[model samples]
Target chain A: MTFLPPITAYTCVCAVGRGRDALRAALTGMVGGLTRFDDPVGVLDTFVGRVDGLDAVELPANLTDYDCRNNRLAELTLRQDGFEDRVRAVRDRYGAARIGVVLGTSTSGIASGEDAFLAWSGEGPLQSDFVFEHSQDLYSLSDFVRRRLALGGPSYTISAACASSTKTFIDGAQLIAAGLCDAVVVGGVDTLCETSLRGFNALQLLSPVPCRPNDADRQGISIGEAGGFALLERDEGGSGTALRMIGYGESSDAHHMSSPHPEGLGARLAMTEALEMSGLRGGQIDYVNMHGTGSHLNDRVEDRAIADVLGPAVKCSSTKGWMGHTLGAAGAVEAAIVLTALEAQIAPGNLNLKRPDPEARCRPLMETVPAELRHAMTNNFGFGGNNCCLVFSRDDAR
Target chain B: MRLRVAGISVIGSGMVDWGQAQRILRGAESWDADALTVPTPTILSANERRRVSKLVRLALGAAEAACDSAGLARGAMDCVFTSALGDGAVTQAVMSALRQPGRAVSPTHFHNSVHNAMAGYWSIGSQNHQASTSLAGGQGSFGAALLKAALSLSQSGRPVLLVAADHPFQPPLSGTRPTDGAFAVGAVLTPDVEGAAGPLLDIEGGVNGPASETDTKALHGLWQTCPAARAIPLLEALLNPKTVVLEAGTGYFLSATVSP
Candidate 1:
């Protein structure tokens, strides 16, 4: 009952770069560390990974009807690297009718909106810019991307919290397998905003220090922002370089909304399903991208769940240190990282970790290591117990 | 690629108020019966209900009706929940809290604010461990949800419950009124069994073109109001024999053919 097509091309825009070429370079460690922002929030002192030199530009006159920095960043990210042309050419070749776009994110443009509302009241409508409105709405980013790409196919935006983007991959596959499309573009884009920053800060979840995933003194996640995109097709042959989305699974905990189920019930369900879909046992996976947000609860729950299913033998690491928790962008961004690791044959080191959590149920990767890997899995469990797991295998061999 | 429309249910707002569901069996049989009289309460327990948002409640109501129509227990159905704005009230609340830095985000509101919160609540309420998905497609949320549900049914050899819901805009964002009310709709899909007489449907076509006259006709047959009411159009299309295609505006497309 395979219902998804093979992935065709995958690319991302992060603190690393905008297009595949830049991404490829970043994968090779050519791109150094991103800039750090001065933080008034005490927990996380400075952001480790971030796209440098992204300034607030005047919004297009016609497009200045909304509020949201999230959406603005989305447009800027997609506009970079001639990504639209690459997407358009792919769609044109595949037939626009057969190409679909799916995105994953949370708090699409709330930051801009929240800011706009404040300005409008204090400074007056003349002082308030309409562009702020577009940034605040969650759909702005997806709608903007859809319109910009001129994608006439099924366009969807998934918002399952951190797992949002990972689920995008699965949805794209389903769309292609249903014969609804020939090719589907799936990814996530989220921009750092006061909404997330202040929200996490209020929750006391923001660590003044850089996030340390699987660390004994792990404090909290550093909320970074990024956008990632991948092109998927039903056929692997005759297509350009592409990674096969071998298998994926999703589940919900119905547990506490913000908190994961103590036992990682939903996480386990998604992991098991993904493994079953690949026709591979749990132990077959060589690498795993843990959804380690460096938060107290998330890391512990995920560690227990991974250990319970894949066992301690599976090599897993959290890449949050490299780019912070990109929220919706985490899934696709991390996916790109995994693909990069596969190409480079070396796993990226988990930065900012002092000591491993003594209570961890599974072993965690502390340093960069080379592993000629075949299969890898990335786990993203969002708020409200929504969980998604994606399995990636190299096309040449598997 | 082809799947059957095994079962479907729509719990109108009228039912939620009356505390009794009204079933509208389409085609030759239009029985407006009290939604399968049940002694068990339709709403969740007080403690459980407090934990879920209004959106989840509406979805659960529809899922109950869908599961009943499909002759499956709540535990037997896998679920997929869809919404455009996804509990805007909760989102606004969280934003307000963030605006006031150093204030604690209500753990409850923070949890329900995620896109899949309602879907998670449905899975918990139904006690179903099957795969559950929450998807967003803007105005095309219903179509997207149905597509996922149909695909899940095709992939998993079990009945799937597709719940689509969206609440009215809360304050600060109530400028636009699209239907202006909270609604929940559900449909149960299963693998087409041997010697089945129901409608055999296959969703095809990608996002393309504005709504055509034919698409409008198909949509007209599907439901009355609630433009986002994808389930109605789906049920209507399945019941109507002449119409075979329902293209859901550059989002998703569904086609149905009745066979004996």
Candidate 2:
């Protein structure tokens, strides 16, 4: 497959910080963003990477129908890093009809649905003000973003659990390759809600303290909320520092619904296929961003898969310890982190690690250190055994 | 993009399978409004069979039938699943549980709440490790699925399985989003026509046109209520080849020219 386009601009907002600079400082300082659970939903002892100042967010008068926590986070992120202006420039260059919008979200404004459900008196119908099409529908995220960015091209939302956003890159590229669009706005957004918090609690996957990936006594995951976006267009041969998505691989485990394959067979296949697609050897990969949620099964299986596929010599780490597991947003958030590491020419260390697990095979970075990287890979595995691996490279590398 | 349909399946009220549905479309049989009955998938283990949701049964049942009709290996082809509202029953159950005094959610309900739960079950039952994607485009979900399937086939140069399904929501919640009944459709699309058994489809995106409407009263009712039923016009075109256009999103339509 030929390279489709390069990611010209990207931005993200999470518990760590708002833009690239803020995130860089948090990563370099090894500071985590988890706080005690203070929401009035469930009675679980856990920590969450919650974003600040969402209640005060207000939507435009015309788009009041699309108001929700998810879109609020999307609006906040779009305002940062000048992403909205970049999208408008692309729209002007190609026309609104030529730019597509493809976003990934697991629960698109379902929090509103919960609210409506709670408001019901167990009688006639839901409140008159509740609009399902604009808020609770799975297509709400893409529709809201497309309308907000003023793009008229093909738009859709992917909902494959945690692998949602990473798969958006592949979909965006496919749309461009098919000549359906010239440029695509690809990203993901997920907000904190009672359902996800209580759901993870019921599954026994929430950690009481901040998550510690690759640690000897890691507890579990600290759920997080985030929003991230990237602009992908055909490379016209300009910027040397441009980061291009070289290759991607997706696969399903076919083993279990909630549990990953014990041996990480699907994970290994995704990574190997990505490497093959990029035409890169395992030894050439400078770093790996693992989908380590700090879960015992996830970290152990991923460590084995990374060691077996990318080899134990390559440095790797999971940034989830910094901002917690952002569920659907993890893929895009981690991809942004990978791009930051490449631009800074440094590998970030595991944030909450004290002692590395003795059974782990992969070599994990324990401190932030300077290094030159040409190509890097990031992995995101979701519920129902969905797995996706993406490879990013600098333009100068080719 | 041009492609050939290798297989097709549809399940809904009184529309049991593709064979019966074809007869019904040809005016040989009558449409029934009886509640749709879903069968247990033979591919799943007994343990999994008991755990699967009604939505999963509807989706996997249609997918299995399509692959069987095409004589294609289900495990080898990439799959795309689309739904406007995924598993309304499960969503209501989870939401209701969350409103309880204890606010304790069931693990089973929580795991089944993901929009890709059906895709997960299909992969596990068929043992297909290939790429699988689940998507939602509101009322335009069927068209979006077709567009994605066409693009994926062109990119991979392989056969693709496309499935669209939706189930109704219960009362109070139904007031906000109302779907009449359960509906699902599956088709195997291939770039090459070497082993194709169905009509050739010339699909193009970004076409400015109005969506086609169905004259059949039953089908029109389904089309008005269920998002997945928007495929009726395309399905009618399959029986009698012609050009059909459907809304792909807010401002554009996906036009398909069907040929024998």
Highest DockQ scorer:
2
User: What stretches of model 1 exceed 4 Å from their correct place?
Assistant: A1-6, A16-50, A56-68, A79-83, A120-138, A237-242, B13-45, B98-104, B176-179, B195-200, B206-227, B235-253, B256-260
Q: Could you give candidate 2's per-residue lDDT for residues B1-260 as a string of tens digits? A: 99999999998777888887788777888888666888688889999898878888989999999899889999999999998878888888988886688789899889899999999999999999999999998888888889989998998888999999887878877888668877889999988656657789999888877888765666777887889888888999998899998877666688998999
lDDT of each: 0.68, 0.87
Chain B: TM-scores of all predictions = 0.76, 0.96
Best by TM-score: 2
Model 1 chain A: lowest-lDDT 10 consecutive positions = A124-133
Residue A77 of model 1, lDDT score: 61
- Write model 2 residue lDDT over A257-289, tens digit each, in one string: 889999999999899988988999988889899
Give the fraction of native contacts in model 2. Answer: 0.80
